[model samples]
Target: MEEEHKFIIRTYSKAELAHLYNPDMPLVSAMRKLRQWIRRNKQLSSALAEAGENKRDHSYPPLQVRLITRYLGEP
Candidate 1:
């Protein structure tokens, strides 16, 4: 008898990420900035969601800014 193992893997490419960043952007060059930003700051997405649910004032640079600063460092 032989033992079998399974594993999960994920992959991402600059072009793919760029497309995600901006669907409107030219396929040739979407910049991928937003995609990279999200990848780098996964926490931001969660934090933003939380802020939205709480109905907190997101306009001012507070919740988001603070979270971003803590994760990415001072601007």
Candidate 2:
């Protein structure tokens, strides 16, 4: 899913994404780091907020996931 190689964009759980980004860290810490990264990016944060902010939400919608990947460059 790194390049344009026919990757299928899909919804991802927060925990799943956190694990993807920081498998070396504990789950909670990893999730916190992911959230921190999102919050730190103004463009990404605003876009997500416009879509409907819900930090407590368990998973990301397909489109929101797209934005995340676009901003964060594919977990």
User: Best TM-score goes to which candidate?
Assistant: 2
In order of appearance, the predictions have TM-scores of 0.37, 0.83
lDDT of each: 0.48, 0.86
- Kindly give the number of clashing pairs for every candidate: 0, 0
List residue ranges in candidate 1 displaced over 4 A. Answer: 1-35, 53-60
Q: After aligning candidate 2 to the native by TM-score, how far in Å is the CA of 53 from where it should be? A: 2.8
- Tens-digit lDDT track of model 1 for 1-75: 899643112232435434543668785556445435645676876775665523232232355445544554442
Tens-digit per-residue lDDT, 1-75, candidate 2: 576544357888899878887889999999999999999999999999998869789998888888888999875
Q: Which regions of candidate 2 fall more than 4 Å away from where they truly are?
A: 1-8
True lDDT of residue 25, candidate 2? 96
| Model 2 TM-score relative to the real fold | 0.83
For candidate 2, list the clashing residue pairs, or say none. Answer: none
